[model samples]
Target: MKSNRGRRRDMQIAADNGDRLSKLPNDLLLNILERVGTLDAVRTCILSRQMLKLPTMLSQIVIDLSLRDLVRMNGVVADVTDKILSARSPQITIHKLKVKFLLSPSRCLSIGKSVARAMATQKLDAAEFEILTPRDFQNCTEAYLLLFAAQLNNFLHACPDAFAGLTRLHLQNMRFAELDITNILITCKRLESLCFVECDAGICSVLNVEHARLVEFTIAFGEFKTVELSYLPKLQRMTYNYWPCDDNPLVLGFVPQLSELNLTNAGLSDKTLELSQLLANVHTVRDLYLNFHSEKIWVRPECSWVLAPVLAQLRTVNLDNLPEECDFAWTMFFLEAAQCLEELCFTVWDHKCCRESQKSFSKKTDVKWEPSSIHFKHKNLCKLTIYGFQSDKNFTSYIRRTMKTAVNIQEISLHDRKVCKICAEKFPQMEARPSSYPRTDEEKDSLRKKIAAKPTMVASPAMIHFPS
Candidate 1:
């Protein structure tokens, strides 16, 4: 009904109102684009001519393909990386960049060269690379590992600048030579975090790590006789899992600032490792985690005289995957020590799949430990959590003992057992024990009255939770 000029003005107003995102400030537009991934951001700006330059101005760049996408997208990833690096302006500083690609020498050579050129020309704050092997750990043969490691070496050799400025690296499924890993450590001088999954030297080879500025290290499924932390002064957290060793798994020498340690292993052997020998050197550890894989008791409890000094600064202790059939009273050996311990958590789970598939012949042995005679009342322990909680004599007795020991305990949490789908499907014949957790408010109050009426219960007014 209006004239042509008036209709054109209305259409312009509608379009201007619709395209509000582009009119935002440059700083805010960059922030929004960065929150979305770099790949998605570039795709989003395809039709918008005013915002086509935002991708080049982005500070954080991440080009990661999922597990199902690596094979098909490896070449695509290389092409995109090269395009991004070549198109990006050197004036804008890239704060963080990560590119993950399959270990193909040709593709890696292209990507590595682009990143190296960027490092030389632009202001890249930190660069990271996650190199994936062709095959998985189970399917990888020794020859495959050697070939993949050599390909990675070639990539490193081609673009030394990329690795030199890298802050994090995760290598998988490789059996490096004795000096190969040491050389990597020497070359990656600015590395803050490093991880190796299913990687090691030859059989029975000791992995002696010596790094000055490394902060976090993790090794999973490695066949090392002993991984000696020869010198990692600034190390904060270390995790070691499934180290197939009969002797002590780790030997710490000069990890002064180490505060957290995680160890996970499934051992059915009768050999029990002593913590006194394992942790005699590092005393600054504040968080400790040990997982037994619901099999045998692998760690032997030490006397207070031997363990107290080592656990002096320990604040949190998590003991995971204890078999549900075993008694929980033996874990008090740590509670009696650890004067500064604030939180103690325990998980009693029976992983049927892992037990039957991994070590079908190994039996779950009973843990034997007695409380220390030295009278030391704990005042710092305020919380206790139990997973796979059963309303049985073992659980109640353990709770009473903890309540009495920790007089100022603040709260108690009881959680239902964590069920694994694979475990339930594989072991369909095995029936899970029914939990006796109270259902109604009246029943819960009745249990609370009973717990409070018991004479062994402490006078501390602690709250109890039964989470369904």
Candidate 2:
């Protein structure tokens, strides 16, 4: 039913609109180019003459050179990188550059040299390099390590001025000698954030960051080892997660500006005492997180006495996987010392202390443990959370004692399978309490009835479970 003339006019109008819309602004088109992979972006050049010249507008570059790809392309990979770097006129100012690859020792040296050369000429604000290969790390020989370290050293030395304007840097899965990292830190004087993930070298590395203006530092050691941290003077946040090594306690002497510290899966031997001493010396820390996993550990008792004085300034504390043999007395002493404590999370493992109560009940004995006493007072205590609770008289008594001691307590969260009705009856002034479990409709209705019977100050109970 359509006339040929009408059909042709409609087609012409749609083509005109498509042409107008396809011509995207330079910035918008560059954003689209950045989201695609390098190979895909290169393929876009063949789509049209306009796209042929659009690759130059990219200000961020990511190079992923896998071992298989490298073997397949042979010399083509390096050539492409060289061509890409050369094509940017007036020296492209890259905001970020990321390179990831698996390389042989010889290839690593060549790539490191090439990267150093590029860094020496390019103006980069941030950079990340990751090398992951099982062959390079499988019982690697000392000679191979030295060869890689030497090449990395040359690369770092070549770009001493490149990191002067950098704010972030991440280096992972690379083997570097002690002096290699030391030189990098010394050269990157303005780096504010630095991360070293799974980097290992023989001999404990010493980081001298006194002159560097670093704000955040995170180190995750693949192998159990120690690295010195005594020279960081301006660091604000530090996170350390590593396996235990036989190295001495890492001494942290001049990090006076630090405010937050997180330690996960960290083990301390007699050096635990040294860490306590160092914490006592720090006057600026406001938050501390400790996650311990070992049992029969007397580390806390020894450290608690030394850490008591410093606890006065702490505002928050989180303790996870606390051992059964850990002296609760020392823990209470430390808690009392925290005069301004606002939040507290205490998690015990395996319900060790609660089992004794069960045994006593079966034996028809009236044995009861004394409530943990407080020495210093927490005037600002408002929120308290306890995990791994059991339906035992001992735990109920502990909860009752906490409610009696905390005068300003406003919220309490108990993470347990079930709470004794007597314990809930005793705490009649808590607000905003909730459980971490699902309830049937009937049970939910019953809970609502019970809540209606209670006063507004007494909140409904909540359930919390440990992860499997």
lDDT of 1 by residue, 297-337 (tens): 78888787888888898999999999877888778878776
TM-score of the candidate numbered 1?
0.92
lDDT of each: 0.84, 0.56
lDDT of 2 by residue, 210-327 (tens): 5457888887764535556666778888887654464443446678887887775524333343345556557677787766542323234333445556665678777776543333
Task: List the candidates' TM-scores in order.
Answer: 0.92, 0.63
Q: Which candidate number would show the highest lDDT if scored against the true structure? A: 1
Q: How close is candidate 2 to the true structure, as a TM-score?
A: 0.63
**What is the C-alpha RMSD, rounded to one decimal, of candidate 2?**
10.0
List of clashing residue pairs for candidate 1: none
Steric collisions counted per model = 0, 4
